[model samples]
Target: MSTVLRSIRAAYCTQAVVDWLALEIETARPTQFQWLQRTLADHFGDGKRTYIDSIDADASGATTRFLVRLNDDHCRTVDTVRAALAALDQRHTLVGPALVKLLEVSLDFYPKDDQARAYLPLLVARLQTSLEAAGGTSHRLVGPTKRAEHLDSTDTPDPRRTLYINNKLDPLAWRVYYKITDRDQTLPRDQHRARVEFTLQGVGLHQYGINTVDDLAALDFGDFGHLLHFRQFKPLPDLIANMKPELAQLVQHATRRDRNMISLYPFGLHAYRRYNTGKHAGKPRNGGHPELRKHSTHTTADAELNQLVRNRLHDLTQFFTQNWNEK
Candidate 1:
């Protein structure tokens, strides 16, 4: 069986913070223990048991906890642990108290016993480097005060859908031919290469939110390789079926909203323009110094993806605010 081991050392102002975190983890949806169990079961054979190595909390100062032996055999144990931790961080943002501060988290992997202890120093150094880099807000938001105004002014209410199609003819053909080949026959050294191409097209109709398969189809995949494949391949349905009931519902709702926005391409563009321009005091066409303008133009492409992600996050925040109390 595969396994993952993790150790977390947290420095808190008081023991209260540690206690709160522990309680929060216990109460968390997809509880900490549940996450551990599910993760292990997904990767390893159906083993419901997880062994906790240690849980030490210093009431006088900070708290340190170690979680070892999370059985997941599919991938690198350390990487999986890191992913679980990151997911925990995101969940904390959604449900945790404002007082809880995650000062630092470090993760390491040990495929073999000999490599484990030696990696701690490196992990500490990496943590120190990240701490050193942490300072100040990276950027400030400006421009329109209201969301509707921003959306309207920027001319990006909703963007059009763009499709990216990937037809894996070669792989399918190879599998079909390979099945007929005798075991004694040597496999072909040079297999045919698969052809994958992206197609960008506007959705047929305008939709306020994404909530349906057709709505999701409206998302533009020209810019995002993954999204493009999703549009063409329609993998979400399969994924939803595989996910837990609650998670599947959430994904379905989110996917629909995402696709609806994509159907209105120019509107989405306008929305982003409104967000950026509203956050800052600048003209849509010209604002920054010539050099800054050149730099900003070069950076705008990257910003497109960022804005799309932020839009979705904003929607998610609104969702939680409406559904749950924030306090």
Candidate 2:
């Protein structure tokens, strides 16, 4: 399959929606967050609105946060933003059932973008109209008390600066990171760099009957080479098992090298086993049908099997040393 590339931008304040979408797509599930965002954007036309960054629900044990950035021009005073969020919270409590019902209906509708958008405006308008009909006041409960309190006259804010509802635990942070850092632009590039620190744990190979480091040291010669010499041997599984100690050591040493020698393990093993006399032939001569088609209970033990196993181990060791030591 050909590789498909996608470029994404950081969305401020819509972190919850972006995160929900990522999780849903990764797990092959459906989500309502995407629908809500699209619906709001379409109807509201990117209006200045305040959404809760964090909410603690007593009954559901659910915590919902917002990650959104404000447009400079539409930037209301902090007091206004806080008040708007409070109003939104009250609306959420009052319209909880309606919101859930909408989500359920939207879930059943396939081709979400196309179908959901069609009904979204109607839903939003209906919601507002219904609330008013129920005697709820349409008060501007959030945002600055006066329109003059707007921070900037700019109509649009920097789209790259993402606004999130939660202060930490950003689920969509990786997605945003890939977008901002890896995206293509027309401008000349300058060398920029950053560093990240992390920790990793290592495991030993004794779990696979390989006790003591010497058992690995002893197989440094032909024993490792024989494993890869097989023409048709599938070496991945065996190589992984045999080279655990060497790999663990590499991690311990923290080497920075791109070793290509490891490719030989699979290649050599596959090449050597391609023409082996046993399985390639149809006859039952050197074992049963050369394929070792079935284990004959009456047959005597053969030394070739042991040799084959030993050779495999040797090849695995060689692969590790060659690749792991490369600079």
Per-model TM against the reference: 0.17, 0.15
Local accuracy of candidate 1 as per-residue lDDT tens digits, 1-327: 001112212210000000001111221332334444454454445444544322343443222333334322221222333344444445432233211111111111112333433333332222211111111111111212322222232232211111111222211100000111122354342311111111112221122232222332233321232221111112456656666899888877876777532222221111112224343445546552212221111111223223333343343333322333423
- C-alpha positional error of residue 95 in candidate 2 after TM-score superposition, expressed in Å: 15
Q: With candidate 2 superimposed using the best TM-score fit, by how many Å does residue 208's alpha carbon deviate from the native? A: 57
Per-candidate clashes come to 28, 38
Across 150-244, the per-residue lDDT of candidate 2 in tens digits comes to: 11212211112211111123211110111213224332222111101111011212222233222323324342222111121223344345457
lDDT of 2: 0.23
Give the distance in Å from residue 230's predicted Cα in candidate 2 to where it truly belongs: 69
lDDT: which candidate is best? 1
What are the root-mean-square deviations of the candidates from the true structure over C-alphas? 25.2, 27.9
Q: What is candidate 2's TM-score against the reference? A: 0.15
Model 1: per-residue Cα lDDT at residue 286? 59
Candidate 2's displacement at residue 193, Å, is 26
